[model samples]
Target: MKQFWIVGLGLLPLVAGCSLFETNPVPPSPALTGVSAQDAAWKDQIKRVRGAEEARFEPLVEAREAVSAALAQQGVNDYDAASLEEAQQALDAAESGWAEVANKRRPNGDKLAAIATDAHRATRLAEIARYAAVREINLEKLVAVNDQLETREQSQPTRQARPVTGDARDLVGQKVVPDQLGEVSFQPGTARMKPASQEIVRQLAGLLERYPSVGVAVFGHTDNVGPSAASLERFVKANPKLEQQAPSQAEKVRAFNLALSAARARTVAQLLVDNGVPARRIGARGFGDTRPVASNDTQAGRQANRRIEAVIVPGPDSPEAQRARAENAGS
Candidate 1:
């Protein structure tokens, strides 16, 4: 049997087995223009990093990830600790200026601008360092390696790629417009779906079962009533009969609105799985009131906001895809 393993990241391979790991070159961060990496800021950072013509691709991409991690608090910034440290200094200055404002003093805008410029330069230098480290420091080795590459390129021209059949559209993954199960909703202050919502997802779950390659994403939302933690607390207090069967601790609610949103999303995801959708293909998240479709002050508007929306994320067939596939296979 072909296995589809899901790791902690919630992303898995669209296909299984050795069709993955085919001799593909890791061309760089253009590797993910996919749904998950669609943020404008992320694309801008990637473009700036990949613009280094003189540097090898791997080192530049690796360095970009290092800066990203340090800023995001995910891991250590071993690529350029000093630049990362300097960037942090800018943040410290901004924080200090804000503190002065609390004391009735003028806030410093210069420090904030400096932070932006400093971060940009740091990221650029991180990419440039890859080329400088090899070419400027080890001139003899660089020249020797260049000579070998030039000779090879001259003697053997690049081969033409094999042509694929059908239209170009057929080769890429399809992204369908998300069907939002119109008027679907949850009971007030709880994750329990009304009957209409259940019927809609049941049909969607069947469609997902029919299309194994299509991926489903569930985003939970709230009506801006309050934070998710507080909302969840209120729900627990009011609905003691249902609290016993509630989902496990999220550990990181921070606020109640988000907590309620998450609970609703998990509820929807579970319902879909029970209906027929494969668990591995479903990814869930809570948007709270951040992405409200209507104003929260009105009852109708609040009702609209308190709903779940699902999208079918298209799979990207790239080096990253292959790596994800490899990781899934291993898992």
Candidate 2:
């Protein structure tokens, strides 16, 4: 027993020495410790993204953020792998554009334009993946509902073909609104629809077609950025009767944002109309930056704030529908 204790005590110093040696291994040579090209490129990208955000390069920052948000979404990769892959490809293209621009320290206007175009494409593709994922999730819920109905029908004969009334109707309506609408990006400072936004419009149209009774209230919102003079002039021209009550620059900016948001909402509504959704069942409005789902302090939050959301109204009795009716009557 004494020998065993002595041996254990002797081994303690050996274990301590091994740990010390492991923790203090000789540092690699400077050449060997250098980052690989790939690693350096990745670091450059990180810096670029941060710099873009700081410089308020909306297109590049938004593209980077959108792709990241889409990829991070739950089940996005699994449910919409094709769109997700396309998004990645577009992002890669954007990254390549950045790298090309980096080589030309003073990129010309054309090269800068090309980079912006690539970034916009990346943002659109990422939005497509995100919207597709949301649609897939909604479709799965609908399929589950169908399965539940089938099970009930098999258990009882009378409950079959009951027209999806009551709770089921509410469930479908609730699930139909793509909650990720806040991530649906648009062209910078324009009502023009991105390719991915078109997908969202088509999906909304299909839902309206499938459930004729379901009405949608489309609401547009904007970030806190004040409108340009040209935009404010356009707004004032279009909304002569709804002119600003106060002449404060802030108030005018608010009015401009409201009008711009409304125009964007109308653009989406027009797309729905073209897609065969009845105009009567659709009510479009704008809240400007009033109802932000996220902070407007950061680029990511601002992107989220600048969005168009669609609220599904199940029936005439719904408060949303009633409010729409009231607004129309007043107008």
Q: What TM-score goes with each of the models?
A: 0.39, 0.42
| Distance from true location, Cα of 141 in model 2, Å | 28
Pairs clashing within candidate 2: none
Best-performing candidate as measured by lDDT: 2
lDDT of 2 by residue, 177-259 (tens): 34533234578777887897788788778767766755555668898887678877676667666564545667777777787
The lDDT for every candidate, in the order shown, is: 0.47, 0.58
Off by over 4 Å in 2: 1-168, 171-183, 233-246, 315-331
Q: Name the 10 consecutive residues with the lowest summed lDDT in model 1.
A: 1-10
Cand. 1 Cα-lDDT: 0.47
lDDT of 1 by residue, 1-331 (tens): 0011122112323211111111122223333355434333232332323454322222233444544545653122433345456645544443443344323322233432333344444454433332222212222222233235335535766733222223322322211212333545777767788887788778667656555555555667787775366655665566565566564444223245676787887787788778866565555566677666678789999877777766443223433345665774696
Weakest lDDT window of 10 consecutive positions for candidate 2: 12-21
Q: How far out, in Å, is residue 282 in model 2? A: 0.9
Prediction 2 TM-score vs. true: 0.42
Collision pairs in model 1: 227-256, 227-257, 228-256, 228-257, 228-258, 229-255, 229-256, 229-257, 230-256
